[model samples]
Structures are given as structure tokens and as C-alpha cells.
Target: MKKTLFFASLMMAAQLNFAQEWKPVGSHILTPWGEKVTAQKPHPEYPRPQLVRTNNWQNLNGLWKYAITPVNTKEIPQQWDGSILVPYAIESALSGVGKEVGKDKALWYTNTVTLDKSVNKNNVLLHFGAVDWQCDVYVNNQLVGRHEGGFDPFTMDVTSYLKKGAKQEIALRVWDPTDDGPQPRGKQVNRPNGIWYTPVTGIWQTVWLESVPKTYIVKTKQTPKLDEGVLAFQATVAGSQAGDEIKVRALNGTQVIKEQVGQPNADFELSVPNLEAWSPSNPKLYDLEIQLLRKGKVIDQARSYFAMRKISMEKDENGIQRMLLNNKFTFQYGPLDQGWWPDGLHTAPTDEALKFDVIKTKEMGFNMIRKHIKVEPARWYRYCDSIGMLVWQDMPSGDLGGNHWDMQPGKISGGNRDKARSQESEGYYRKEWKTIMDVLHNYPSIVIWVPFNEAWGQFKTKEITEWTMANDPSRLVNSASGGNFMETGHILDIHNYPDAAMPDPKIFGANQVLALGEFGGLGLPIDGHSWQQKDNWGYQSFKNKTELLERYKQLIRDLTRLIPMGLSAAVYTQTTDVEVETNGLMTYDRKVVKMPEAELNTAHQALYQAPTK
Candidate 1:
């Protein structure tokens, strides 16, 4: 009887252990970092790199109990299904809960944190790196606030939500209609096939808590004027008195460059002497220290960095319009980077994984990346700025109903046949586009703003393009990337699939630069790395790596031929395979290298050589 009882105990213990072990739930392709994920710590890095605060902050990105219920339900669930990974979208494999939450269903998350009394004495601020669609945040069951938008970051002051103890309970309720709603969701839908992908609901980025002084510098905007050798900046203050002043300091690796005094919420310029211009080949960044002062005493301080660079257009010796970086013509060649991960979707699994694509693109001899129809986390752009990779940012497309298109080089008309949009839709586009631009404007890598892509939600072509150009005059504007021919923007762009092509200079030679926005989607699907086994496809499919490489090399050779014809820049089809689209330079899982990097780099090098005068 005793032996029997002991065996029963062992069996019970084993069962509980098995139940608690964390494992990814989906069978889709997974990245290397995804394979190594656990419930302990995920993406444990400072989420905001540009605004660095090293002390009095905590990471809340481990496992959290989650539930999916009908959207009509409001009460918190008495019991959770299981632990889902925080910061990974619920539909993602890395979330450990590959469950779909539809438009009729609402997703929920709950976690607990132990507040440090030493730090909690200061004002506590709750930060959600990003949440999909719409969400309501609660601390200790009290409603703190609400937010809308799937891409940008939002924060709330939750100090009042704290109780007398060290522990505090936080909850999140999220609902995302995905493609069902007319929002800025990029290629995500209820049905997953072709270019559209699985819906991402709930928290998809780092969630954390920080303590700050009552009077803190909430945000800082920096614009560098290299020609004038000065950095113009402005700071937004949260809680401040009338006489509060601001102190700014610039440093180049411990050597002080400049220091100045300015008032909060006032425009000020700091002289940067002996400044080195930032470019693709030579990226230099200067560290910045900003402090908020009250009566000559420091109240709040933050750290940041900046780069001195300029983007413009110039007429070359051949009397052709050319895109110039720092007053020099450097042909921008890169991939149409659709920022997606097999494991995390919009959010990358790790910081290192996030930077991997940019590093590989640079290695493959690409100077620029057209961030396609989607916005990435701020860190992605920061990495590009640090590594000196140029960026052309595209506003994510929505309500995309318009005429079909063909790459008509040198077309005189912008084909101004834009989509007829309702007033609500037009206002939504304008507001969101402006907000996105304001958020990402500080990054020096983004040289161009692509307002529309392939006529997707292309409306008010002249007005939108002109507004974009006027608002950010520092960078050249590609108003429509491979869309309806527009006469308003700086570049005349076109898209052609699976082959090298370019806009003709014959028609618009004097006014606009000619560019091939997209081309060369050479696809090779390895058996184990694909999202789906049987139905995967690319714009142009190849049987093996050898054939893919040869075809890719030939395309590169053909692209070089267009340079003398006033082709200013070009973008390849994509950086990596996402879901059913198997036309990536790298595999979805990122394990297989379809083409030899050295050979591809060699081919890409010839495109950037000096074109004949």
C-alpha cells in the first residue's frame, strides 16, 4: 500500500510539471530566437533607444494570464486559459497561444508587478510599447486610460492606481478588427493567404513601468542643419513652472562639443563645431544630454543622440535630376522591407533579430531600404541610423480601392485618377500621416517619404503630395511609389515585378528624378522554412538556389544598364519571405541563405559606380 501511494504522488508531480512547461503553440515557420524563447524574460532590452533612462525602470514582458471573450463582455475572467507571452502578438507562435481573436471577440491580459517603494515615492508612469487597434488599460481594477492606434507608443500615469503594498495588478483589454475595419493595418486579415497575414491582437511590444519626477521632459524634437552647423531642438514638458529653464549638452565620445540654455517649449539652436556629416558610408552620431532646471537645480534629465545629414536633389552633369545625399549623387539601391517576423509579426522577437535584416542588407551591398506600406518599431529605424543605412518610409495603406497600374516611365500625366475618398477617410489619412511623420521625423536615416504605394488608397494626389513636400522640405518626396503617375512629387517612380525596369527620363527629364521603386522578386522555397508546404509562391519562382542566383545576377546586370538612362534609384521586391510569399532574399525562418552573399554584393556594387556623363 505504501509503495502504491508513493507512485501516485510521483505521477501527480510529473503531471503538474508538464502542465507548467512553456512551449510555442503554432506549427508555422519560427525564427532562431523564437525557438529559444521561455516565459522568464523576452525582449529584455530598453524598448526606447533614442530616449534612454537607465535607472528606476522595470520590464514587464514575461508571461501573463490571458483570455479571449465576446466583445460585449466587460467583467474580468475568473480563470485564464493559460499563460501567454507578453509583447508577442496573441496570434503569433512566440506568444505560446496561437489563437485568433476575431472582430467579435476581445482579447485580455493581466499581470502583476512589485513596486519598489524607494522609486515609487516618485511619480509612477506606465508605458505600453504598442497595442493593436484599440485598448483600455487598468491598474488595480481602476480604469487608467484608453488608447487607439496599432503602431505608435502610448503612456499613462498610473501612480494613483497603486495600493499601500509593493504589488500592483495591471490589466489590458484589446479589440482589433484587422482588415474588417478601415484602419491602417498593413496586409493583415482574418484569412491568411498570399500577401495578407494573420491578425495580431493584444499586446505586441514591451510593457513596462517607470518612475519620473513630477516635472519631466516628456519629448524632444531635434532637426539638424548641416549646412549651418547647428542643431535645432524643442522639448515638451509634462509638469513645469513658468520660470523653468532647459539645459542642453552635446558630446562626441566624452569630448564636449556644445552647451546652451533654453526655455521649455521654446525653439533653440545649439552650434555643433567641427561636425562630421552622416551618410551611408560614414555614419557619425553625437550624444545629447538634456536637463530640465528649476531655479538652477536639475529636476528631470534624459539622454539622446543625433546625426548631421542632408537629403536633396541636384541636376547632374548630364542635365538629369539626381537624388543627392550630402550634395553627392549616390544611387539608392535596396529591398522593399516588409517588417514581418514568422514568430512575432509586427514585433521582432529580439533586439538582435530586429537589427539582423539591416546588417545583412548592408553586407549585400545595399545602401537604402524602402520600408514598405508599414511602420516598424522605433528601434528598427534607430539601428539603421546607427549603421548608416538610408531609408524611404511608406505610410501604411488602407481603404485601398483604386484603378490598376502599369509601370509607365516618363508618363506625362500623374494619372491623377486617384480614388474618390469620403471626407472621413481623407481626414483619417491626413491626420495619421502627419502623426506618423512627426513621430519618426528625428531619425536621420529616412531620406524620403512615400505617401502612397501602387495606388492603394491613393487619393488627392496633388494635395497630399504637396502637403507632404511642404511639411518636410528637408527630404525629397516620392509621393507615389509605383502608383498613379503624379506630377507633384520629386520622383517619377514605377513598379515592375520579377525583372529590372526603370522610369524613362525622356518625358520628364528636366523636372523629376526617374526611379524603379520595385523589381526583382526571385523566389526559392526551401522545404522546411516555408509557412505553408504546398501553396507557397512568389512573383517569379525558381526551382533551386543555383537558378535563383543566376537569374538574380542577370537582373542586377540589366539594372546597371539603366543607370546611364537617368535611373536615380531602385528597390528590389523584398528583404525576407513573409507567410505565403516566398520571394525573399532570405528564408522566412532566416536559417537558409538562398544566394551567396559575396556574389550578390559584387553584382550590387556595379549599380552604384559612377554613371557615364
Candidate 2:
């Protein structure tokens, strides 16, 4: 009887272990980091680095129950379908439920948040890094909040909804229309082909819970003035009384450089005696600490950082406008980064994987990256700030139906330039663009803001450009990247394929900075590293690695000649091959790097020389 009971116990243990195991659902290629992910914990780092509270927080990024119901369903379903990963989208292989949730269907998720007395504080904030399209969140079957953007983070105060028990349930219903709606979804489409890729639904980023005091700092904006040698700091305090105070300190390592005390929601400037300008060669950053006090007693505190750098434009000896960093002319050159992963469609599998691309870009000797049509997580920008890589941020393009593109210089006309969008579409664009700018304002790496790309969803050119300028007078605005050059913004940009070219110095170089937005799409697809076995594509395809390398070298040589003709900056085709687009320096899965980094670094050093008359 004892032997039989022991064998039964072993069998029960084995069954439970098998049930708990998790694996990726699809057969698509995955990055090395994706293979390391487990169901126990996915993104185990702090979600918000800018406003960090180290001790009292929980990372809720494991598995959760998911269901796909019709859009007409009003209430949360009683039974869920199966278990899916919390951060990965339903259409991705990492989610363990690789299925499409279209316009007619709504994706739902349910999870429980346990209230541990040691971790739960006076106030609880539920935060989401991002949710695709539209999402409505509920806590304990009560609606908490609804958010409607694919790229911006949102938070909700769920402290009031806690019950007497130790567990609280969370339900999320997400709806994404992809190309059918007039939202700002960059390159997602229902029928992905060519340049377009797969549709992402539901959560695609980290979700966590944060604990704070009754009166805490909601947000803070720290802007550095390089010319005046001062740092401007402002805090948005929540639940503040008349006598509340905000104390800020700027530190170099453990030593305090400057300290100041001010009222909440008011700006304060602190002076730095010896300020070092942040550049690619020396990316120096100063640590920061902010505390909230009531009558000289500390209530809350958080940690942050900032850098001292500046971006401006000035004319050279030849009367051509040149891009300037810290009042010095420096040539900016890099690839168009798409920010996609084969395993995790919209999100990187790990934080290390996200930083790997930027590290590789720095190793390859590029000094800038034009983040094309997609906004990455906050950590990505932090990596660039510390590693000294300049970023050109692009607003995701949508409502792409009413475009009349004119790419040439002299052929641009007022009639076909800006598309007239509907009132609904226009409202969505304005709100989301402003929110994106507000969220990314503190990062020092972002140097330029791009509004439109090649007339895709371009509308009200002069009005939008003026608004963007007035909103943030600190950085330069590209207005429109490649086409519909209304000559309103600071840059005159153009796109050329397979060859190097620039805007005419005689026509617009005196008034605006000339930039080659895109060029050099040299392609060579590896056999085992491609998305598909056949039908791979690029702007210019090659036979092998040797031919591709020679072609790339010739293209770089051609690009170097144009620098003397007032080309201030240039962007290559891409950083990595996304989907069927094979014109990338690296493979889709990030496994194979076709070109040698040392040779590329050596070749790129020629483009930075001072232009000769």
C-alpha cells in the first residue's frame, strides 16, 4: 500500500510540472534573448526610470488568462480561453496565443493583483507602458480608466477600488482596427506585405503597480540650458497643500553640486559651475534627487538624471545652413531604425535585447539614428542618452489614404501637398502628437522632431509646423521628412534610392539645412536567417556578401562627396531587415551581421570632415 501511494504522488507531481511549462506558439524565427524568456517573469525591471520609487513596486508581467470575444460583448466573460503572456501581443509568437484579433473581435485579459501589506502603501498606481489602439481597464469588475493611444503610457489610481480581501482582479479589453481606422498606427496592416508588417493587438509592453505617498510627485520636467550653464526643473505635484515644498539637488556621483527649494508646479533654475557638454565622445550625465516636504518633513522622494547639450543650426562660410551641436558643426549619419523584433512584434524580448541594437549602432561608428515611424520604450532612449547616440524622433503615420506625393524639389505645389483629413482624424493626430512630445521632452538624446514622412497623412503643413515650434522651442523640427517640402520647417530633406544625393545648395541651402533622409538600400539575404525561404526583397539586391560589401562601400564613397555640397545629415535604408524588406545591415532575427563593423567604422570616418569650398 505504501509503494502504490508513493507512485501516485510522483505521477501527480509530474502532471503539475507539465501543466506549468510555457513555450512560444509559432514557428517564426526568434532572437537569442527571446529564447531565454520564461513564464515566471518576463520584463522584471522597473517600468518607469524617470520617476523611480525603488522599494515598493511589483512587476506584474507573467502569464494571464485571455479570451477573444465579439466586439458587441458588453460584460467580462465568465470563463477565459487560455493563458497568454502579459506583455506580448496576441499576434506574436511570444504570447503563446498567436492569433489575429481583428475589428470584429475584442481581446480580453484578466489577472489578479495581491495586496501584500509590506508592499502596498497609502496610494496605488497601476501603470501600463503602452496598449495598442483602444483599451478599457477594470479593477474588481469596476471600470477604472480608458486610454486611446498605441504609443503613450497611461496610469490610473486604483487605491479607492480595493476590497477587504487580499486579492484584486484586473480586466482589460482591447480593440485595434489596424488599417481600417484613421488612427496613428505606423506600419501595421491587416494584410502585411512588402514594407508593411503584422498587426499588433492588446498589450505590447510592461504593466506594473507602483506605491506612493498620499502627496507625491506626479511628473517632473528637467531641461538643461547649455548657453546659460543652468538646469531648469519643474514638478507636477499631486495632492499638495498650500505649504508643500519641492526640494531638488543636482549631484556628481555622491557629491552634491547644487540644491534648491521651490513651490510645487513652479520652475526653478540651478546653476552648475563647470558644466560639461554631452556629446558622442563624452556622454556625461548628472544624477538628480527630488523630495517632497510638508513643513520641512520629507514625504516622498525619487531619483532621476539629465545631461547638458544643445542643438542648433547656423550658416557656414559658404552661406549654407549647417546642423550644429554645442555651436559646432558636426555631420550626423546613421540608419533608419524600425524598432521591430521577429519574436516580439512590437516589444523587445528583453531590456538587454533592446539596448543591443543601439550598442551595435555605436560600434558600427554611426552617431545618429532616425527612429522611423515607431516610438520605443523609455529605456531605449535612456540607452542612447548614456551611450551618446543622437535620435531623430518620428511621429507614427496614419490615415494614409489621401496622399498626393511629390518627391521632387521644383515640382512641389500647394494644391497637392497637404491632405485634408476629417475632423475626427485631425483631432486624434493633434492630441497624440502633443502627448508624445510631452512624454519624451526630458530625454537629451532626441535632437529633432519629424511630423510627416513622404506626405503620408500630411495635413495643414504650416499650422502644424508652427504649433510644433511653439510647443517646444528647444529642438529643431523637420516638418515633413522626404516630400511635401512646404519650406516651413528648419530642414529641406529629400530621399534617393541606391545612390547618394542632396538638396540643391543654390535654391534652399541658404535658408534651410539640407539632408538626405534616406539612401543606400543595399541588400543581401542570408539563407537560414531570412523571414521566408523565397521572394525576399530590397531596393537593390545583390548575389553575395562580397558584392554587397563592395556596393555599400561605393555608396558610402558617393555619399561622402555630397557632404561638400551642403548635406548636413544622411540616413541609410535601415538598421535591420524587417519582414520581407531585406535591405538591412543585419538579418531579421538579428543573428547575422552581413558587413564587418571595423571596416564600416573606418569608412564612415571620412563623412565627418569639415566641408571645403
Candidate 3:
């Protein structure tokens, strides 16, 4: 007892030391939530919302020992420079080590965790929400797993590496090439300027651990079949025997509506009576309880939820394609949301901070958001789902300096030629995109998938578009938003600056949904909230808030007129200012709202109520 007490005291003293040493390292503007961050527990919430095991998991998101080493140095370091806040990039202010780790250096993180061996049933799984570029994970100095791709979550089983003790050591070595490599890094550059922003390195999302039974449910796909009034449910079990079964129960606020049992690794169709279709107005969600059973005895279980929603396309009376939600035409209008923070960079400061943007978007009376070349954390999409906000998810653009971005009204000659990416580059793109889709397949808020944006790294456009459609036929695929105008996919999207416009209805409106993928970049940079004091810019700079509001209202009026002329959707320039680009409804720090949300909401009602052909 005395020895354990002494060890506990030592640990407490060490934690206090770390708390005193850790501080946000930059002078850049910070959001209200960023200011509240501490080294004790940063983003301590459960990382995986989709697959919830309740208190059976642990968040590994506090300060950890970090070191910057030369790229050629493969051995683990004997000495560490200082501490870094886990799940934040080294370049970010919240990491407390605001130093850039470019292509020439590797970022190393190491930490110790205490595992309750008695409670951890059969297997221990180490999970990373995301790690930028490439990473190699070690468990007690043993190479447990290696993963690439900066956006997708990867898991490794670290049970075998455990000695017969509660304390386990974890280490990770990460290397991100940023722009030097052909990976799908979006808007990240070593020398950030204009539209591009700071380069993010190493871990930028939640890292955690989950303990589960020997036979556990890895992931489940819950697709809402609205037409048939059924939910197509499938579970992927990790370890299973022939008799192992999965019992699924659909609940409505603790009341079980329906239940079904099926063999592990098989599909189960559950009848949903009186379906309340999820939409921008009424986002109804149903709870789920899945249990893994063997010989009619429950061993493991998880809780999750899903919404019944459908997205499709149909031609109107004038033979113009129109996007339909739940078999009804709903004009979608929203901002181009680039999920970036001045403090955390790619990661949000807290879960509440992450949900704030989505909540604000819905409050502004926008039905949809074009996630501009950036994928947010899963919690961001969950907030969108619950708050009745539609999302158009874009694949992060990379492999630049080799593509044409022609967007002439009548002619798209320059964009016809695609970038010739090398074999490795093409392979990386394919693998990462598939992984991202697989990870985010269960979210209902995502109505559209944008494979490429503005001809950036666009290669084999038709092939890629067809594969995307075939992979998930549940959602519409925008081939390339404002990129090469290919006769592919379901939408023909274009971009116009500071004005609301759509594709020529007489030309491309017959077979495709006419959409203004980007427009209305009216900029008004507030004095203190601006990323940089001078040289801030937008497509059309405004002097004051009143002027900006007037111009934005005019753009909405123009966009309303296009709705009747076969215009299906329109995405404004952006949701918040990013770096030197001062074209956002809100400032980069999220401190000030350029226009009143009530007024913007009232003005946007006209576009949704506009008559369609």
C-alpha cells in the first residue's frame, strides 16, 4: 500500500509539472473554446460516436512526450525535447509545440497508459481517429501496425504486446510530406499563401483505446431504404464462430420498436413502421442496440443511431434534372464550409466547438453545406445529422501543379485535359478515397459525394466517377465541382464569383442538375479577427457590414431566380474566413458574425420557397 501511494504521488507531481509547462504557443487569434483548453484533459469526450461501447473505452488525448527527429533517423530517441498536446498537429498552437515538421523531419509521440486487465474482456484495440500522412505505431517497442492516409481512422490490436502488467507503453512515429508528396492533402502547403493554409503534421484527431470481447462487432452499415420503409443493416464481426449471432434492436426513446437476429457477418432487414423521413426540417433519428451472442448468451453490445433519409434525382416538367429529397424537390443553398481553425488547424478545439459551426449553419437558414475540399471529424457530421443540415462532402484535393482549371461559361477546353498522375499517386488517391467513404458510409446527412474539385489532381475523370457511383448508389455523385465539364455523374456544377448563376439551362440542363458549386465570396475582414492585418482579400471586398449584407441579399435574390430556371443547388464562397482569404460570413476566430443570423435566415427563405420548373 505504501509503494502504490508513493507511485500515485509521483504521477500527480509529474502531471502538475506538465500542466505548468503546457501553454498555447502562438499569437494568432483563438476562438472562445480554444482559450479554455488545458493540458489535463484536451478533447476528453468519446471519439467514436457511430460505434459506441459506452464506458468500455478510454481517451488518450492529454499531453505526451514528443520529439522532432531527422527523417533518416529510424531509431527511437533516448531524449525528448518537451511535451505536446495529443491529437493536435505540431504546427498548431494548441499542440504547445508550434514547430513545423516538414518532409525532412519525423514527429514522434510516446505515452504510458494504465489498462484494467480484469475489465478489458478479451481483446484490446488501439484506435486513431486520424493521423496525417504516414505513421508507424509501436506497442512496448514492438512494431504493432503501420498505416498511411491522413484522413481515415485505423485500428490495431495491441493485446498480444501486453506484458502481465496494467501499465502499457505506446509510441508512434509519423511523417507527412505535405505538398511534396502526391497524397490527398487539401489546401496545405509549406509556404501557405492566398487560398492554401498551414501544413498539418502527425496526429490531428482523437486517439483512444477500446476493449471488447473476443467476438466483437467491428463496424455496422445501416442504410435507410426509404422507398421500401426498411433499414438495410449489416454487421462486420471481427472474430466469430459458425453459431455466433448478432441481435439488433431498433428503439424509439428506450422503447424497442423492432428486433432481429442474424448470423454474424450477415445482413438483417428490419421493418420500420410509420417512417419519419429525415430532412432539413424534421431530422428524426432512431436508436439501435446491437449485441453479439453465442449460444443465446450476450457477450458484447454497442449502442448507435441512424436516420431514414433518401437522396435522388428526377427530371421536372421541363426535362431539367432536379435533386429530390424524399421524392420532393428541395432547393439546396448553403456556404462552402472549409473546416479550419486558427488555433487547432485541422482539428477543432473541443467537441462543442466542432458542433458550433454546424449549428450556426442551420441557424442561418442554409439547408446544405459544401464541405469544401475538407472532411471533418465524425462528430461534425453527427451534429449536422441531428440538427437537420445537409452536407455535400468533397474529397480533399491534392497532387496539384499539373491540372487545368478552366471555367469559361460556354467553353471548357482547358479542363478537358486531365492531369497525368504517376502510378503511386493514383494508387494513393484511390485507396484513401475508398477508405474515407467506407468510414463515413453510415452518416445520413451526406447527400452528395464530390470526387474532385476544380480539376485539381483530376485524372481519369469518367473512370473515377463511375467507380464512385458504383461504390455507393445511395447518394448522387458530383463528378467534378467547377472542374472539367465531363458528361458524367448526376450533376453539372459550375462556379461564378460574387454573383449567383447556374449552367446554361438550354445546354447542360437536360440531363444534369444545374448547380453553382461556388459563388458569393463577398469579403469584409474585421480589424482584430483578420488572420493578417493587411493584404486580406476576397472575390468582392466590401467596406462594412451593412454593405456586405446588402450585396449578400442581392445574391440571394439572383439565386432565387435561378431556381425556377432548373438551378438545383447553390453554394456560397465560404462559411468562415481562412488565412488571408477574407470571404466568410463569420471571422476566422469565430468571434464575430458579419451579418445577423435572423436576417440571413429570413432572406434565405425566398430561395427555398421559389417555384421550380
Among these predicted structures, which one has the highest TM-score?
Answer: 3
Number of backbone collisions per candidate: 2, 0, 0
Candidate 1 lDDT by residue in tens digits, 228-337: 99999998898779999999999999998999999999999999999999998998999999999999999889999999998888777878898888878888999999
Better of 2 and 3 by lDDT: 3
Model 3 superposed RMSD (Cα): 1.4
lDDT string for model 2 (450-569, tens) is 999999899998899989988888899998888788868888888889788887898889889999898888888888888888888999999998999899989889888988878899
Global fold similarity of model 1 (TM-score): 0.94
Candidates' RMSD to native: 4.1, 2.9, 1.4
For model 1, the superposed segments whose C-alpha errors exceed 4 Å read 1-21, 402-407, 412-416
After superposition, the stretches of candidate 3 with alpha carbons farther than 4 Å from their true spots are 1-7, 116-121, 410-416
Q: Report the candidate with higher TM-score, 2 versus 3.
A: 3
Which candidate should be chosen as best, given lDDT against the real structure?
3
Alpha-carbon TM-score of each model against the true structure: 0.94, 0.96, 0.98
Colliding pairs, model 2:
none
- Candidate 2 ranges with C-alpha deviation above 4 Å: 1-21, 409-411, 414-416, 610-612
Residue 160, model 2: lDDT of: 89
